[model samples]
Target: MFSYNVNEEIQLRLLELRHTDELFALTDGNREQLRQWLPWVDGTVDTEHTKRFIQSTLAAFAGNNGIQAGIFYKGNMAGCVGLHGIDWGNRKTSIGYWLGAEYQGHGIMTNACGTLVNYVFSELNLNRVEIRAAEFNTRSRAIPERLGFVQEGKIRQAEWLADRYVDHIVYGMLREDWSMNGQASNRFEVETDE
Candidate 1:
């Protein structure tokens, strides 16, 4: 599990069923803001559903499959960040994240991503991590650029969402690159095992 306080105004907190209610509220509050990026928001979200979702995530973490955390700004849930579809044998992981529109353009995602990537490299000992985003999502694309991740390639029609296929831009960074850049923050370790 990971935990950290970002200055006095925000924190990156790990998720648990205990926080499911808050998570559901935040997700629901940001549904339209997240709909473009997240398919799960297509349906209604309730405490029970989100609670079960969190349970599944915890179970995945317990099985060494993935981990998800709630983004907190000033003690309130803002959005979600997660590492999923992990391939431990290959020493690789993928990051997925979103912030409420209200929190966008505040450098919150950059800070959150930097904090998570540092943990992934230094703590989890991952060889490489990648982020895939819709090609036209400039805000999402900017994260990799700001974080020094190289745009490896584009996977054409890689994902089908909302009845349409979309191109995905793949961006990646390695531990060596991260170390060379000295952008790794010494915070919590990335727990692939949750």
Candidate 2:
């Protein structure tokens, strides 16, 4: 299991099928808020949908592709953060994340992302880590910006939400940049050894 004990208040754990109910409930409760930026909100209609999503995440881990973890705030489900996928040939991976509506303003994602970037560039030795946030989503875009990610460019109509296409602002940090800038090196204790 991949678990990061980020602090006394925030932690991240691997998503499992057993967490379907809790995860689904979180998603259901934030459906309106999430639907604004996330394209898959309507599709995640029940626990079974969340179960299959967890199964896929597990399979990705087993196949050494990537991972997704459930964000825990004071031991409660908050959201998720993970590598969307790894480009092994290029040693690059894109990070994706979302937080529960109520969890905003706590800086949960900023620290969670810092932990993941540290793991990716330091431990995994990945060359590049990318974070793409929808152009209009200021809150989402701030995570990478606060962490010193360089804005690469914009991809028009990158994703389709419920009603329309949203442009994505790509931010990238290279291995050299991470080392030189000291991007995400705050203390994040791992509960389980990798």
Candidate 3:
């Protein structure tokens, strides 16, 4: 298992089968709010769905393609952040994340994202990381903006959220840019279950 301590109050842990119940509860409880920006909320109708999702993430990690980690706040699961998939040939990846409605306004996603960005550059040696958010999702867009990511462009009708199509605003960060911005410092301790 891979776990990272983001701070005294926040931690990131690889999602596992054991987390299915907790994860499902969180999602089920926040269905309406999460459905606003996340398209998968409707698909995840039970713990079984959450289990399958975790299984896939574990497979991705095993293949060195990407990771999906649960964000923990004070020892409780709060949300998730992850790399959609790694393009090893291009040395790049995209990040995706969401938090429970109750976890909003705490800067948890921002810190988790920053930590993941650092890990991408320093540990994975990835040259670039991209984040795409719905054009109207200010909260999601703010994470990359706060982390100094450059606005690359916008994709028209990139995603269909429930009944409507939403444009996506793309943000990208390069390794050189992250280093030059003085964000290379490792602010968290990483632990691997051995």
Candidate 4:
């Protein structure tokens, strides 16, 4: 239900099944690119399946468990990011994202993550956010690092990806850290420059 601009070229909009066709098309177009880091997508996405998934996510959002967004760049579907498996009383949530291969290396994801994290802390009133990435996923890990998230350590054999169990690096950021030092608007200090 929320909408925000990640940058001049990109818009991040909260998602629902009403755009199932759009979701399916984007996911289908980048199946192989996604499979390298995300094994959860089995390359079988279609409009019907996307609708069901979006419905499930919408239900989660209603129950205060999650929010999922479809990333749009210049009016075209570009990728996705989600704050899921929420624990409101604990004031914590996990962040996850995937960009089509075409969208990688453009800093789009870093900007999107920063904006979403800001929204979660300010608008959703969350205290802490966690981001986990497979050990080999440099692109994924960079999002949290560039946002000033603290590296908490790694969980050995934490996630199953590419048909094998892999270690996962966990990163966390508290609301205080973000508000005090991580805001993107402060021209004197950049989050990544630290």
Better of 2 and 4 by TM-score: 2
**For candidate 1, what is the TM-score?**
0.90
Off by over 4 Å in 4: 184-194
- For 1-194, candidate 1 gives per-residue lDDT tens digits of 76876556567777898998788877888887678766788664578889888889889888878778888877778878888868889999999988887777667777777788877877788899899999988888887778889999999998777778889999999999988887775332222211
The estimated TM-scores of all candidates read 0.90, 0.94, 0.95, 0.91
For candidate 4, lDDT tens digit of each residue in 1-194? 67898767778887876778887888888888788778767845567778888888889888878888988878887898889788878999999998887777677788788888888888889899999998988878888887789999999998777788989999999998888894735222222311
Best by TM-score: 3
Clashing pairs in 2: none
Tell me which of candidates 1 and 2 scores higher on TM-score: 2
Worst 10 residues of 1 by lDDT: 185-194
lDDT of 2 at 149: 91
Off by over 4 Å in 2: 187-194
Q: What are the lDDT scores of the predictions, listed in order?
A: 0.80, 0.88, 0.91, 0.81
Two-way TM-score contest, 1 vs 3, winner:
3
In terms of TM-score, how similar is model 4 to the real structure?
A: 0.91
- How close to the true structure is residue 172 of candidate 3, measured as C-alpha lDDT? 97
Error of 1 at 65 (Å): 2.3
Model 1 gets an lDDT of 0.80
